[model samples]
Target: MSNASPSVKTPLYAQIGQRIGQMIDAQVFRVGQRLPSLRDLASQNGVSVSTAVQAFHWLEERHLVEARPKAGYFVAPRSRRPALPAVSCPPRHSLALQRKSRTETIAVFQPQGQEVTFGAAYPVVSFGGACPKDPLFFDDDRVRVALARATRIHRHSLIEYSDSPGTQALREAVARRALHLGCQLLADDLIITSSCIHAVGLCLRAVTKPGDVVALESPTHFGFLDLLESLNLRVLEVPTHPKQGLSLPALQLALDTQPIKVVLSVPTLSNPLGAVMKHSDKRALVQMLASRQIPLIEDVVFNDLLAADERRKAAKAFDQDGGVMVCGSFSKTVAPGLRLGWVEAGRWKDSVSMLKRVQGGPTNVVLEQALADLLSQAGYEARMRRLGALMKDRLQEARGLINDSFPRGTRVSDPSAGYTLWVELPGQLDAMALFQRCVAEGITFGPGALFTATDRFRHCLRLSFAGAWTDVERRALARIGELARRQGDAP
Candidate 1:
């Protein structure tokens, strides 16, 4: 895999460009397919625009891709084809849920109050990774200006506790934004919460009580598992496809067989697998929930990150009987430090609002106003576009690395949007063992066991490509592959 020659070293940009060629040869990208924007390619590969330009030129010279005027590069015609990963098949049973024991915890956490320094867990090019704000995408100055302006302009509202369901201005902003997701909303239906997870928790509390059976995707989000466990709920995990968000038929079967009370899901850009449910499937899921009279707590946090407009549509958009409760936050798509999330509970709006009132008071008016300003600003859409392109590039880069370094039998999910990747190694490879070894080498990753109630995905793991693809981080990923290979080779 070493591309460097004996006499001369290959440039990083050249290597990246060559990787793109390999992808084209392998038919991972098809003929006439548009390439990511030049800036996006640069950001994803951790190179400069000039470097990406050189890379593209190199591809052009080799006849792998051709540039179109005004449009981006596209893959040239080729004969070879590349195979995609297979869909996932989770076990068909409810699992005994347990909390994370101290010993089971991965040793990747730094001491509290320590200033977070990326790639600082080890010396000499460390790779201990955590989900941090990418400077390439987020503009810190813009956020600061918005916060300062809000504090100055809304100083009068700081003295008193606002409405229990959040400020009207912020709700109106959210309602306006929901239109893009194909959701029709009124500000009165929205209730702001501390965070997205908090919004989900509130929705769960509003509908179901302790000991109730809740259905969710197999290999679901770890945070949802923790929330369900904290609420003393049993889990009936429905099988999920890597490409499709959830298996509707399996969920229907579960509904018929199990005493399911509430079904929770992240339909658009689901975590770990990064699955974006098809639009038709979203509508079908909504109707199914309505037919059963079961409420669905749909997490649409990653909806805005989707590339296609139709893909960004919320499951609640198709809910005819108000059976879907949509929850979302600005942390993933917008400002992370704001700690703001909202829920639009259809029929159970009063119940969710009541639960919020009992659990906590109103959200900060100043922060709400600031987020409102940010969301309403014209620059917001442009920022989202840049972010989407950046993530697309990073995903392609990481996937290339995974294919190059991992074992031959390894498979990775190709999500339509978002920064998370679900990797399935060969059967014999234990993700927990790989996680421990990677941690020993000062690299951090999420093992698959953490995301499930059962031991179904012990051979799987999740990686977040949210950060910059610096040399250290890239090397760390390769190092993880090496460690996994060693583990796989063991007797």
Candidate 2:
């Protein structure tokens, strides 16, 4: 055999193209800004001038970057795409919409009109939305193998309806995973749904009726609040802490004062604030709810992304009276497109199952089988380890940037786990107004108002560093700081 190891086939033009592409994406060349001379680029990347020219030509062909005579190459302006249609939801009443007229007005909803999506608590990666960076990060190879096996075993099953309760294998796997979290469950205790949101909807339908009161965390998930409102349920906001999570004393007060029927919270790595409740507190909460017989809807989407030793203990772990209904999903961990989530309804299993059947019949059978296969392949743990490390590093970078770039008096809530950062801006700078400015600059973020029950966090905002590049995050922070300073200095 030759000592030359198969002459590692290197394509010089392709390498040049990739480098230029990255530079454009990094905003090294702004829209309508001229690129450096081909000779300079060749010298910089150590390629021939012709190769650099060829790369620019390829970019032009793809409409990614354009060449201007004497001005050189610049990033092409992206074509504006049509907006997505507004999601049709049934009319309902809640604090968010109750302020508006009671008349059935179909508000023209367009997600594009919203500025700085930091208001929404989705992970911000290149792909955008709440999708994870590596869909197969937790044993992609295994998922593929399992998908193949499932396909062979159940042909045309993809077109058929899934088991009303969900696949036995997947449910068993979920039960096993729940046991690890200190909840004793069997396969029958589970009801699979399309996603955590779906699971929440099912739980809500099972317990509360129209016009009934439900207690929610002060700075809770907006989707949950919206869902409750759509179902015509009255929402009572309970005080919650930024670090300790939902305040038990406040919760008790609310339960005592209001005729609340359901309590919804994310006990682990709570969205926006990223706080995890203590085990003792969880036990107390479980007991408190049990005493009132108030149904608890636990959203644990971020449960699996915990740091190795600090895995949060769930409220379901302490449910001796079976009032806690735990909802979790693989969307945040495995593949969001799969839309696989389950609810462990201790005593409400039957109700939840019936709700699932009524809602949309059943979940996708093929996808569930694929996820089950993915979990069983023994690669899930290693994948999580790598993902956890990446998330930690990214979050640290984000925190450092915020601290260094933000103006004085700005406070940041440091999360022990998860990829979100909740920041309180200085002075009377409104987050919503700041978001509009950010949108004008082609940057997006979550406003703090959406996270709070009252509009008290008007100066705060939430950011996701999960999918953003380090340089992009730095620029965004700097821009935000400048805007904040300007707002503060104004009369």
Task: Output the number of the TM-score-best candidate.
Answer: 1
Residue-wise C-alpha lDDT for candidate 2, range 122-219, written one tens digit per residue: 22223113445533233344446667788888778866655478988888888777765777787878888888988999899999889888877756
What TM-score would every model get versus the actual structure? 0.82, 0.74
Q: Give the TM-score of candidate 1.
A: 0.82
Count backbone overlaps in model 2: 7
The residue-level lDDT of candidate 1 at 467 comes to 63
Write one digit per residue (lDDT tens) for candidate 1, span 43-152: 99988899999999867755678989999999986522213445556556565567673234554443346543444544333322223456665666666888999999
Model 1: worst 10 consecutive residues (lDDT sum): 1-10
Clashes of each: 0, 7
RMSD values for the candidates in order, in angstroms, are 8.3, 12.2
